[model samples]
Target: MIGQRRHFQVAHRPRNDDESILPLINIVFLLLIFFMVAGQLSAVDPFEVEPVESAVDGQPGPDEFMVIVGTEGRLAVNQDETDLEGMARLVAEHLQRHGDAARVRVKADGRAEAVEVVGILERLREAGVERIDLLTVPET
Candidate 1:
């Protein structure tokens, strides 16, 4: 009887070429940092000019005009400062140009006096402005 010998070959795993992932990860991190550094945050509207509150919340129509009153009695129409008489004229012109449907929104500083706000409101009334709104920030 002859003795039989058998040999078996084991296959080794192929080497991975995945070292490129490290550079890709580094590039991704760098791009993430660049975007974060380049991104800009919009400036917040001044808190000193806190607006008056309203019971109703909804989108304003296009005919609406914004009037801002500061604590120092400064008056602004659509963010542009104007005198009392000028404001009246401006409001009148706007109403005349935009028609009777025009609305007015008053944003007054929290510390502003009632008289100042009332004066502006009166002027607006005289200008034929019917729909008036007092702007305010919701309590957080």
Candidate 2:
């Protein structure tokens, strides 16, 4: 037996992970793109301004306009901090551009005084806005 020659054969399978890993990476990239695109488009105001709560809810139009009034009565339009005069100008321009189709919404801080809010409303009225909508959070 020692003198006789013996032949031994061994079969090996190579690891094949490229196929599975490729699909996994592709899915990850797709999810990353989806999240990047779907992130919130609304811009946050510079100062904290909690909106007043409202029981009535109305759907705003597509070309909706929003004006932010801070707790200190500072005005911000389109996320651009400005004076009350600038806010009025912007609102008037938006209304002129979109005509009656434009819906203007005022987001005022809950701590804001009624007089300040009324003043803003009066300015909107002066801007030729027939009716202005006040934005509020619904009680949950």
Candidate 3:
């Protein structure tokens, strides 16, 4: 009996490759869900814009319209890229649909040409946008 060989049994099976990464997949999915729920996702602009800094702060209204003017004279109306003519047409259409209460805000890049910015403002005003504001970030 002492010379007899003892048989050892394995208690658990070895994990598969997919099973090894299950915890990692779960963690990644949890992080993605957390950001989607906790983060405030807004419409992105067509191009990058660094708004000029100002000393004063302005309270934006709920019905405000956003107009983006990029450094290279690129224009966007509420995230939709368009030319000056298209912007005016869109602004006019928006006014007709939402009424004059919807104030327009021009977010021009700091390096944007002043003449172009002024021209855009002029075009917007001609489109019957009465209350147009220049959006500026608070100076640090």
Candidate 4:
């Protein structure tokens, strides 16, 4: 009888040194953090007025009147709604009380009609308001 040849076999194990995804994940997380901080830093306060940049730079003093024209053709004094006649009366009264030292600032909504805003301006002018500033939003 011929003697059978014996063979030895070795068990196979998977390689555990793979590290391709670790650096990618770290980079992704760092980018996310950077974007988050940048987004927060870019946040700014909403403004009602869009001031045109000018060479003249100074802060407005007190005794300024703010008139707001709502989209619905409603007139407001510092956010208080007033009708056309009522607005005229109020302006007249304000002028009488505060004298010529009052400054008027008008803020009309973008959707507000030009006629309504003009009417308000005329009323203010008739009421002896000399210093009037129109407030507008800055174009992006």
For this target, which candidate reaches the highest lDDT against the unseen true structure?
3
Model 2 residue 100 lDDT score? 78
lDDT of 1 by residue, 1-140 (tens): 26977778889778677875889999999999988886643322333487766566655444457787888888777657777888888888888877867778887887899998998888888779988888776654
Better of 1 and 2 by lDDT: 2
The TM-scores of all predictions, comma-separated, are: 0.61, 0.78, 0.71, 0.53
Better of 1 and 4 by lDDT: 1
Q: Candidate 3, residues 10-69: lDDT per residue as tens digits? A: 789786799889999999999999899867555567899999999999866545688999
Clashing residue pairs in candidate 1 (N, C-alpha, C atoms within 3 angstroms): 52-136
lDDT for each residue of candidate 4 in 4-104, tens digit (9 for 90 to 100): 88787988887666576788899999999999888874422223422333444344334456777766566667556677777777787778877877778
In candidate 2, what are the lDDT values of residues 1-140, reduced to their tens digit?
Answer: 98999998878678788866998999999999988887755556777898888887765543468788887777888777899889878987888798877667888899999899889989888888876789888866
Order of the predicted models by lDDT, top scorer first:
3, 2, 1, 4
Clashing pairs in model 2, backbone N/Cα/C closer than 3 A:
none
- Report lDDT (CA) for all predictions: 0.76, 0.81, 0.86, 0.70
- Number of the top TM-score candidate: 2
The runs of at least 3 residues in candidate 1 whose Cα sits more than 4 Å from the true structure, single-residue gaps closed, are: 1-48, 58-63
